[model samples]
Target: MDNTLSRREFLRRAGMLAASGAAAPMAFNLSLMSEAAAATAPSDYKALVCVFFSGGNDHQNTMVPYDLKNYQAYATIRQSIATPRDKLLPLPGLLADGRQMALAPQLAGLASLFGQGRLAVVANMGPLVQPTTKAQYLSRSVALPPKLFSHNDQQSFWMSSMAEGASSGWGGRIGDLFLAGNSNAALSCISVGGIGLYLSGKQASSFTVGVTGNPQLLWGSTNLFSPSYINELKVLMSTNKTNYLENEYVKVTQRGLNTSVQLDAALKAAPALSTSFPAGNSLADSLKMVAKLISTRAQLGNNRQVFMVQLGGFDMHDSLLAKHPPQLKMVNDALMAFDSAMIELGLQDQVTTFTGSEFGRTLSSNGDGSDHGWGSHHFVMGGAVAGGKIYGRVPEPIIGGADDVGQGRYIPDLSVEQLAWPLAKWFGVPDSDRYLVLPTLARFDADALQIMR
Candidate 1:
């Protein structure tokens, strides 16, 4: 008469249901799938690459205010980690309020991109439901994103406009809008960074691949298994059982097998890239895989795609000066190589890469390093970008300026919706469908940023 199930029993049943594909539809919205299936293919190819900087990045150090007046304020506040003035890579003619900004010496590759007009800096961006000022933030006048300084929550907020437990990401929603445009909807949103919330949609989810351009095969499903075992597994996957759970598992397994074959063939057919990514850089490895995937777009029958890659270790609560340079250099080198690879592939203008972080570190150092704060600067680069300029208002590098909330954490002048909307518009999402991708976008300005050509 006891109905209670043991933990192992519950998990076993859940796994069986998942394998049967009974849980797949529950993971996504069926109505959204129908809508996406009805949409037509895009006329031309375009892709968005999101390079997520896990852990908060220190924007003050990344994008330095090099002009004498501002530099003094920055150095005074960040005494231990300040880059020397003369050593800074000067960004000639890219000035904000008559004060020139420069990249740290470590970011020489990005500096070159800036000089070549292939990159633009987006200043002081963070998640906001609406336009908010320091006064509003202080007075609790506007609804703010939950858990402002927490890494996981802020990362989710930036990607999905909600804290943790958000069902869909803006990128995934974008993928949902264009899933039908691709021959294989499963591959429309690819992630080299593993399964990220940023690429989880109601109707579409990311197809994760390794840095080596291989699809993630299910356990015991590869050539290492015995022929008889593989055959039995295939038979089980192909069986059309009447039980709902078993049927779902078969469907999901079949889909995975098909996707693996397709991806492997496409990757094999892709031309080798000549661009040299830095040796031993994990970020570079991820970007290299993304480049290979992009090269296989035609073979995969994709006109629109979204890709995500990540690099961690930015949460430098200590050793900021000792550690930040090499990390930044790795990012710089990988991005520059990726840009070159795009050019070599003759798809420079068709691809756009941008940076996102959970939040920015405090402008004021906590002796050895900085703590989590808000309003970080980021970069957007591609042949189509209207580059060599700063897009948003640059906050004065003062500890207690009008923009600063506290400890030089400037309240963001631009929202994540503002940053994402332009990219979505450029990717061919119609204005009517923009709300589906960015739920908070309607509250902010409808006009897309002029950063794109």
Candidate 2:
């Protein structure tokens, strides 16, 4: 076997040879491939992991207020399903005003990080047209996300940054501009919890990794064939490149195989960690796999990358009191584990993790559950995060007031563009490239938001 015949090199040559026919003479040029790889490689080394809550995560429940009046307001609106204020785990840290708030009791795992200044809350963040106020919302003078109450519409709006029916997601848009800087052809934007519209890049689509920290192979048992079978299949894939679809399939499969080989090799070289993630938890397991991948970042030679994972069952349409705590617990625990793992790998500064959801549920309860509403709060956690405080103006718990869009559908105080722009800039996207990654971002001159460094 020729030392130079890497699986990728062979596939590349074989594809070319098949395209031009064996009789037609063409050199097996490796320099062309090298040049192409060099053209796409980036110099920076940063990664972003986005954990999207499929349904609306209840912000009030996640980040609780222990202030007497606010707690009374919350309990009054919640009626039968309100979490007891006494049961809420009080955070020890003093805010700027020396007032104390409690973390959701379930989020006990993350309290320490908050104390360590590695966790922060971005308040009242959602898709926005501009710095529209509650007056603008009630007057209908500004454009708002369409069908804001509908789950499908809101979800799409959240991911795509369009009113409701946008085709592509902002994450995908970021990948589109950033993929030109990636040396690896193994999908710069990947989703571990499965395919999502959010991770779909314009030119580079998302590749999926399984929960067990492996790239899934679609060609099951056939991929396990002996050496002779492998030779036969390779010949078939090479010689019979008549059908365009088949050839494309062959190309993708070969690429996937090569990628898997490299990833597996990298994973094996990663040092094992002593930290233990709780068993049977989806968020914990998914993040454990991410930690494994991040540990291999040096070998993958990727400077910038994006990952999407999700946790579902956040709709909380019923049994809000009984069901919502565990979800928050899972989120808190998983993030704590992930943050610890990043520290273990000395990647605490290099990686930033954040959360987003469809929207926040209403402040007034529907007896047992909550309904979908407009503006919601989100979380950002990393060594780089400026923790211990809220960023956006906190919404008044007053129902049917200026902020509330009837029944507590609060108009957003801060736009998602404002919330995400700083991170995009921090990711090493040049000033000229910001608008390309975030179209809505151009609306706001982010000359003031200090989300990074």
Measured by TM-score, the strongest candidate is 1
In the range 113-144, model 1's lDDT, one tens digit per residue, is 88889899999998777888888999999998
RMSD of 2: 8.0
Q: For model 1, what is the C-alpha lDDT against the true structure?
A: 0.81
Model 2 residue 126 distance off true place after TM-score fit, in angstroms: 1.1
Clashing pairs in 2: none
Residue 247, candidate 1: Cα error in Å is 1.0
Tens digits of lDDT, candidate 2, 1-453: 443446455556556333422111111212112212212356757788898887888887777667787778878877877788888877665555554567788887677776777877787787666767777766889887777677788777777776554546767666666665666645466677833567654554566666664422224454332334445655665655775644555655555545655666777788997778878789988888888877777777767777888899999979998889889888988888898898888889888998988788888888888888778878888988887666666676788887887777778777777766787777766777777667777677675458677
Off by over 4 Å in 1: 1-35, 94-96, 215-232
Candidate 1, position 266, lDDT: 89
